[model samples]
Target: MRGLMGRTAICILIILFAATAVAAAQTGDDAVTEGNITEIYSTIDTCDITLTSSSTIEDLVIDVQLVHEDRIIDRETLNVDRINANSRTIKVIRWNVKTSEDGAYKVLVQLLNNEEEIASKEYGFVHGRQVIPEVVIEGTIANSEGVTAVIRPVKATLVDIDYMLVDGTDVIYLAKDEKISIHTTPLTVHKRWNTLLLNNREYTGLVKVRPSDEVNAIVVTDSFSSMDDAKITDVYKDEIGASATIEGGSQVPFDGYVRFTVYDHDGENVVESVIMRSPILLTGDDETVEAIWENRLREGKYRLVIEIIGNDGDVLDIQETMIDVEKSVTISNDITEVVEENNSSPSFLITQAVLVLAAVGFVLRRRNIR
Candidate 1:
């Protein structure tokens, strides 16, 4: 009876193993419910399709067909794996098809479950054989004097090329694959300078021409002070002379010198005047003062002018002053007095008169030599 019980237990274990295998197989099986094409390419032979399944699937077989007017033109088959059950996933399929005919075609994608159509999706595809061109131009723009205006890029394509300028009413036609460069002019109207302007038509933020090079100008301002205020009493020949503080202007240090133009109101030309040289010094607030003026000045009323210049063709500032010049003078005199109280010969007196007349003639001749 014990042997009979052991054989029955072995038979029961075999039936349970078979039942577990059957359940596992059912759970792993999958079926597709819907399929649809997502995208169709005109240049490249490619199409994307989305497929939905009814259950969790590990593998799937897809077939793609291209049809024109109910006639099959191309057909391809693809195998995919690791797809989720009851979920939608995108599958991309590539195929070689003749696109010489400019017409519409239909794409049919089918998901197969055990060699049976479980899901299908359709899409429309069109092909056109045309060449499109694009054009781009990049450069700098300046005014007539080569001053910077604006830098910009001009782009044009054949598809959409109609544009109007911001300040003018001119219609610009940008051809396909065509690039152009235009130098914009600075507009001055009503005494107001407009840096940028439109063409014939009004378009906001039109192409602006900016200066690519640097710009420079000259600025002049004048000031005056006395040497007494400058605390300069004596001036040497070789050394730099007095200095008068210049104020109320914008000046840059290490630029050009402040030329001291001294003019004598009593003289005819500039040669009768004197000029002083000065080195630049740093001051506050964009102002520079120089102790470069020469101290050697003659006694007279003179005019002083200072000018500031830059290396980049820009004049920053200028100054002018009128000063009274005074110099020290020295004089030496010798005098002899004679008294005729003692007795003297008459002939001696006559000789002395003759000698005096001869001396006067000699002095006159020396004056003529000069």
Candidate 2:
């Protein structure tokens, strides 16, 4: 009876231990609330993953595996200790996974407690390759009315750009394999004055052309004498049927004079004349001089040469300018006439006076005849 009792007690103890083990396995020693795979690479045979758990655990183990078909290509495991409670723990497990393999992969990570899986995670992976090219534009030109000038073009290359062109105030995008043409129109006199802009870096030039017809005549005004010193201050010219005001020296009015000359395209002298004039008269510290001229001019292209004359009859400054003469408009005739009935003029006061005098004369004649 004693041996039987001992046997029963041993059997009860074994049953209790098996039940406790089953309960512990069901509850799981560590719970993986979150698991994440951060980065994956195509060329390199590696991946990075992060793991988080609810409570601190000991002997924490992570496994990385790549399953291909029914075979496992690589497997790795790492041990982590004292993972903090409700905190993330990072474990880097290097595996022999081949990136060149043209197949799908599965990464499996497991947290083990006493050689038993308490939490597990799985993810998918892929491997391949790709690339891209670049392009850009380098320069531009302006052309109009058979005349062309180099305008600054875009300076870029195909390290990243596909192709480019400038339109209005924007850079337009083009295909990788495309040709580009850039051009601008010349400025009109009615629109903008003549000017030139150059791009020094790109060795490009832009010309602004103004509309003009022909030069007509050259007129020079009389020289003016300064108050302090007899120096010329300003000069005047009657050009293209209009007067042009020219500036002279600041101090001397009589010391400055202007010479006007006009030449045609064949180099023949058209108008050769000189006028010494001071347009501004500065007296008592006042800095101003006035010059005026009036002359009739014809319509033609002409070159105007202006020379400033010193008091000693020496030329001080000279400038040559081109002028174009435009046609002028003229009104011809005017007439005033009145159409009247019965030979009467169209005047109310004259007609009323005539009627009043006729009535008075008739009354007088009737009284005389009686």
Candidate 3:
């Protein structure tokens, strides 16, 4: 009876083993298995997932996805109609590692047939090498007449930008909804400064960029502030100098300089010119500056012109007046200079007589010596 009972127990154990084996086979024990992930480097990273299956799958569509630190990077799909049974296959995938943060990654390979998943597997791998993107931003640049800015990328970003202008200096500012309106004449660089505005704050800089209208327009309009509203009330002439009044009007503050130009007779000759500025002024404020000719005036004619310049060095208003200096001096082009002598004065005759006497004495002395 003991021997019979032992045989029955052995048969029951074999039956359980067979049932477990059958269940394993039906649940894709013969299906695709997770394989190794190899990273090949050449400009970018190409990951190949090695998979093998013991059962054939028809109309196969294989997908290999790359994920870095639980974040999906990219996916590659292939149409491999029929995969033979007991075959090892490699699915290729490409991804940019430099664009992603440095961390551990996992590559998942999945096989599909008849729109149904046949087998799915995942293999985790750490990506150490960084593959930078070939191009971050690429575009074309064009400009209209008179420095109209042309920028394609509005949301693009740049770091450590240095810029300057003809009147102002280097400036840096955040490019956010920043409308760059450039209206300028052909002006040259005058001075340079080291102040900049980054993310709405000002800082000092050492790097220098071209002060072209395109760049400086943005910096000057945003980083710096200027309000130009002035009136030049026809320049007037004084005894030996010319003066003009630049009155800030229009209820706007003026924050620039005043330029004065005094011409000689015709408007072509620039006799005296000067630039004066009070820096800051409010509405209805006025400042007067004079450009004086230190020497006594020669008299004939003169013209005085005064101009109000904006912070960008643009001429706001120009007022010119012609003044006739009525004096005793007369000049001619042929004769360099001519001074009218007093005919009734006795000093002229006395000078002529003395000159004649000196000439006669010299002649007499030469003859006596001979």
The top-ranked prediction according to TM-score is: 3
Q: Worst 10-residue stretch by lDDT in candidate 1?
A: 220-229
- Best-to-worst order by lDDT is 3, 2, 1
Per-residue lDDT tens digits of candidate 1, residues 79-190? Answer: 7664565565554444577554766778877777578776676777555534221222232222211111222223221211111111111211111112223234322111
Mark the regions of model 2 whose C-alpha exceeds 4 Å error after superposition.
Answer: 1-44, 97-99, 129-370
Query: Taking the tens digit of each residue's C-alpha lDDT, what string does model 2 give over 267-320?
Result: 576654547464442222222332232444556566766665655677756666
C-alpha local distance difference test of each model = 0.41, 0.41, 0.48
Alpha-carbon RMSD, each predicted model: 27.0, 29.8, 25.9
Candidate 3: which stretches are off by over 4 Å? 1-226, 250-252, 328-370
Error of model 2, residue 289, in angstroms:
75
Highest-lDDT candidate: 3
Model 3 residue pairs with clashes: none
